[model samples]
Target: MAVQDGPHQASPRKEPGCLRGLVALVVFVGIIYAIWWFTGGRDGDDEASSTPSVSASATGDRGGSSGEWKAGDCGGPDPDRAPDGYEAYDCGDPDATFRALKIMDGSILPAAVQCPAGTDVIIEVSMNSGSDVKPSGGIPTDTVCGRNLSGDHPGDAGAGGGQLVKGDCVTADVEEIACDQAGPGDLKVLGLVDAGSARCPSGTTDPIRLTIVVGRPYDTVCGREP
Candidate 1:
């Protein structure tokens, strides 16, 4: 039987479906953000780490380590017997065997022809390697034309002639002297020519012949007015 309606009672509150959906959306977005942080966000650091690094020694600049030689630098053979490499040394050091006269691009064989007239030895860096290899921690390929300071070559046989090269100052007796200290009688070397076949270049006078033996001429150093 229908009873008289009592005072209207309030229904228990239920959470809205939109609020639940909003919470689920916020959780989903948070998960996506976390995934991105772990993956894409670290890409910059990974790329930075993957990039190749260059070292000071590979640059072949002045004051760099051994095998990285430049013009006017001093070095010596690493093993002294059929050396495969060179070790850099101070110019004044007693162990220094050769002085770099020039630095040329490419392999040693081709670059040897470009060496100065007085070059006695050649040091090659990264021979047979490509130029692009330097960025990957490889030495820059180059040829170092060097002059032997050990007084072993024929050019060094005579008195002070070994120390002299083209464009160097010398006395009438073939003694090497500083250009600043040269006197009126002193002469400047125009070129060093092979005495066996070639004559002194033009514009030069008083070609001093350097002999290794008593009669065999080794080289002729052409001289000019200082």
Candidate 2:
């Protein structure tokens, strides 16, 4: 006698619960991004990545001289911000060094240049800045300069580290408002320039060969513009 065939069976049904679990996972990820966007986290990142190529701080403007920067104006790169912002300081202040003479034209920055007459010190800077956060073969990756590190203050000075606004009486030695707000000895901070001391735009002169201590003052040159 021939053997009989076995009974056919239906395929197992798919689990509805498993399908719902996958949908929940996607929803959880969406919520996370929404929170980051609302808390100002997204804006900060955009400024860094989308920030304009680079510009020397002439006046108060980001790029292109706005006349905010003057011959006697001084300040250093802001260590606190990414693509560091510049701040202004009183003349002869220790924290303030670089003085704006005038804007020069050229893709290649001059190694040394004279400042306008009557100006004393020069804080020359250069760096190859593009979209890269890190300086490449000739680009600069960082631009922080000053007495202490970011988030730190020289408590001995009495004044904390911050951007000095115009009219704030500051010390000529840069003890930073440690003394009285007024006196013949003190000068008022005009505006801030937080762009220097970092990497320069492409074609910037080499700091070593061109001179200038990155962000520190350049005492040798005077009375000419780059």
Runs in model 1 with CA error above 4 Å? 1-67, 80-82, 108-112, 127-140, 155-226
Candidate 1: TM-score?
0.35
Q: Model 2: runs farther than 4 Å from truth?
A: 1-68, 81-86, 92-94, 101-103, 111-226
TM-score of 2: 0.21
The true-structure Cα RMSD of candidate 1 reads 28.6
lDDT of 2 by residue, 122-153 (tens): 22222335332221122322222223223343
Supply the global lDDT for candidate 2.
Answer: 0.33
Residue pair clashes in candidate 1? 156-162
Instruction: State the weakest 10-residue window (summed lDDT) of model 1.
Output: 46-55
Top candidate on TM-score is: 1
Error in Å for residue 115 of model 2: 4.5
lDDT of each: 0.54, 0.33
> Top lDDT: which candidate number?
1
